[model samples]
Target chain A: MSVLAFPPPVESEAAETLRAEVRAFLADANAARTPLERAESWNGFDREFSRALGRRGWLGMTWPKEYGGHERSAFERYVVVEETLAAGAPVAAHWIADRQSGPTLLRHGTEAQKRAILPRIAAGECVFCIGMSEPDAGSDLAATRARAERQGDGSWKVNGTKLWTTYGHEADYMILFCRTSGTPADRHEGTSQLLVDMRMTSGVTVRPIHDLMGQHHFNEVHFEDAVLPPDALLGTEGQGWAQVMGELAHERSGPERFLSSIQLLIELIGALRGSESLAAQAAVGRLFAHLVTLRRMSRGVAALLEAGDDPTTHAAIVKDLGATFEQELPDIARSLVDEEPDLRSTSDFAAVLAYTMMAAPAFSLRGGTREILRGIIARQLGLR
Target chain B: MDDVSSIIFESAQRLLSDLSERVSAGRPMADCERADGWRQIEEMGLPFALMSEAQGGLGLSDAEAFELVRICGRNVVPWPLVDTMLANRFATQGGAAPAEGPIDTLGELTAEQKERAALARAMQMAGALDVILVMTISHVQERSQFGRPLAKFQAVQHSLAVLAGEVAAGQAAAEHAVARLARGGAAATLAIGIARARIGEACSKAAAIAHQLHGAIGYAREHRLHLYTTSLWRWRDEYGTQTWWTRQVGREVLAAGPDAFWPAVTGA
Candidate 1:
């Protein structure tokens, strides 16, 4: 059994070269971008920009070369992700696909399934959305009522609605979770995952759900008799609970969790450069300290992942702490700046403040609610 | 560095496990005080890890030291580990043999005998110092309000979080510095400054909070918790407060420019 240990810090030449290459790419991209001249960080999703990243072989830096990946070390990918998030690049378009979906496919998808989709994802030509949440099921993922029934033609008919689907309307496909057998009464035992081609499906409907900022990032997706090939099943039927739990490990812990609001912090610090107030300095120092702790913890998780360890408990810890920091951005910013918080203002400060305030609520709600995450932690500690 | 750190951490973890078991076995807190704790740490060669091979100690770096300190923080291993490490670095920089036993430098003294005298006075005034390492920035007099202590205020609560952050950062920086000094770098000065600032901040904040929370009772020695809080306040102001180190960091940063700020802070 391999015990989890911190991987030696990336000191090899290849790692350094990758870091330099990524830094150069981010510098150029940050310079060229204009109209959407805002630092949306994790929220900003641009398909063209994602494709550009793909062209540079950055989107799938750590998958097998057979699937159009560079097969780089996870540490190298760690550098790229950190730099990208820190630079506030528009990464949401390919974030889910690159981070978890592609990996999940590699682990569970059949050869035909792999050959058909992995390369396109690696190339950033195809975008994917998670079809996990249903109208009734949020954290209770096993409670999804989306049903898939076997047809005489060796295919499956999927029917139900998924809510809060990020980029559902824009995604080419969705790695969806649905019931293959039994009802919610069976919960984990009968659920399974399927990769559905949104373009070819005729029964699918998508409607944008405007967030507080009026952004159409999330949507309500409906599937009425959507036909999927038998091969669309990601893994064996009735094994989705295990598959998704593994995938959640990937989703929960990452540089993105703690870094979403870092750009705003950088901007805030820049504006406070000449200020001599003790409160402002102390507040900034406090934020920096918390940031350091979050980074250390998140890096520890990454090290665990590199060591091929299950770090679900550690991931939950990072998510909870990260959400707290992200949610506190506006309050911290307000205390630092002398001006009023306004979303519509043309100033960069106003724009970032507005974006952060609007985006902050979802920080906890998106991946997992604070209550849910804490419950997981409590369970891990055997307190529940 | 990686191998050495892994070995040290594993050993430290084992030691902590044993200590925790003992604590759970109804061992009194005072029974495991500085003398025994320092011996255990010394036997583990932690102070040696804080020094360089050139200085007759195990060679390490800031990053390695940080890893050690992080583990220590997570376990909440109560001892003057950070303080002793700071004292060792100070002694090494002064071209003196690193102190072999527990040494708590008095914060309110300067000359060696005076420092010893101050520690003695502190022991007389309050209690004993396993090792008193005095710092240079001692407050002239206690600040008071309306014939009452000035430590009580609603603003103090708001400041505690910031105070904790500063202390954490300072301790982190000190750990980093000792690692650098072990590798034979001129980081002892920086480490001392950070240690002074961090200790002072922790002390003052703890004092303010303790006084506010305890009210007039904090002034009474019978309140045992006050000992911990007051010792922190007195010791914090002994060497240097936040104001002193803030100016020092400012001077260093101004001389180096914004580009060097991160490298300086991170000891890169």
Candidate 2:
């Protein structure tokens, strides 16, 4: 009956300094963005904004400076990320790249791959999207049927579809996880990740998938024997399953996981201000309590990751519980306030509430679904 | 996880484990049992965990003291160890010394005191959930229904899973509060306020689910589940109810204004 332990996040002088710097930067940068746009939070894409962050060396914060990184600590990067997410900064352009792709590449990429790609990622010039979920393989990523065959010329040719690919159309590259060998029955066997250059590839096509929210943030990316050079393989051949599993820690541990509905929360606070409603106060306070706990858990994982702990189960716990909070935020807001959520409303609170309500459904679905994460958690608990 | 902390924690864990086994066997905390438990905890030096060496205390780190509380919570120790530590912390800040007794006077819980008490209570709830969860899981595994062990039911497993999530939430909130208090940051007060509010909110759902999953046996006086659930109900409203802390935290957050809200929380 072992329970999960989330240690207090270790304080750092560097993280404190970076936090102030990032907050100041966000205040200035987000001055022009409306509450509706800020409500979009991490999903809001802005390439130039990403570039501005890159100039400040925030994009590749924890990476080594020789590859255009700032050589900062993970805690320092955490501060920047939490500040950016809380301020509702448009970080979509460089988020996936900075969060997982670059780290994955840094850990497993060849020297050439790291040199060619990590610097651009650090500069926020190169945007990346994940190529994990296929139409038939979402949470069951091992069910991936996307095949990458080795050509006689030593290059690879990929053919399959990747669904729910966020920023697929705008991405400069993708860390494509595909079956290098073995059947779908093999589950996790003979998989490999490809560092596919979207711009250089000719047979790839990205079609936008409008979500329930009428947003074009997601896409269906197709590959038709898309050719990749010999160097495209990340880590080892036939080890993509393990490699991708290792990278889930990076994907799951960020502050962005829990802060998705922060704009709505901020707006809710404004609407509830000076109100004599005890119910409203309690509701908002409950949400804030969840937020603080989630942040602590998330930050604890960040610190654990910094200390070179795997924290895979810890990360899953954060994502699962964090999504629950994110999805619940809008519902709590709707209940506490009388305002009808209207996406096009002139009221900042209503507009943000609308945006949050529409986006809330995706919280548990993205990164990983609640059921899948719970299964992982149950397994971690030795229950399955 | 330092050497001294681990040693202290191990000793406390052993004592608590023994006490927990006895309580499980005894079904509830008798007055004599409660008094003995307090003596043991005081002898373990937990009350002075946060007090300085000059004050004849170990003065362990806040994280270590919180860890001890978490362990005690997990076991449902039925002692006022956390309360004593709170009293000691208060007294160390130039207040009246804890009254001379096996336990110190907790005094009237101010907003900060209430929040601290809430965090301690939250930890207890988390611990109690852990005990109930294990008990329920064991019961479901052993007790048969419909020609199969109750654990075979998907509904039972899912309910237990939900219980696990609640326990996790409570534990996370308590730890977060303790961590913030340990840091003594400007937002520490607000952080504790949020922690108490959230944990208090979770109390009902956690208690209800545990009882529901346990069935009639859970409500029985001899079953031992009542020991935890009843304590949870009592402590949940002790310092401040979720409503009290929520309004307190919400008012502070609102007063800070919308623009300052993000920085207030993040910086905390």
Best by lDDT: 2
Predicted structure 1, TM vs. truth: 0.73
DockQ values for all predictions? 0.07, 0.54
The model with the greatest DockQ is: 2
Q: Which candidate is the best by TM-score?
A: 2
How would you class the docking of model 2?
Answer: medium
Worst 10 residues of 1 chain A by lDDT: A1-10
Q: Write the per-residue lDDT of candidate 1 for residues A84-169, one digit (tens) a residue.
A: 77777788888889998999999999998888888888887888999999999998888989999999988999999999999898
> Could you give candidate 2's per-residue lDDT for residues A1-384 as a string of tens digits?
346667668889878888888877887998899989988888889999999999988889888888889888888888888888888889999999999999999999999899999999998899999999998998889999999999999999999999999999999999999999989999988899999999989899999999997789889999998999998899999889889988887898788888889889888888888776778767766776787778877888988898898888788778887888888888888888899889889999999998888888888888888887777666555455
Candidate 1 lDDT, B135-211, residue by residue in tens: 00011013445674333332432233233223333343333333334433335444444444444443454345445
The global C-alpha lDDT for each of the candidates, from Candidate 1 onward, is 0.64, 0.80
How far in Å is the alpha carbon of A54 misplaced in model 1? 1.2
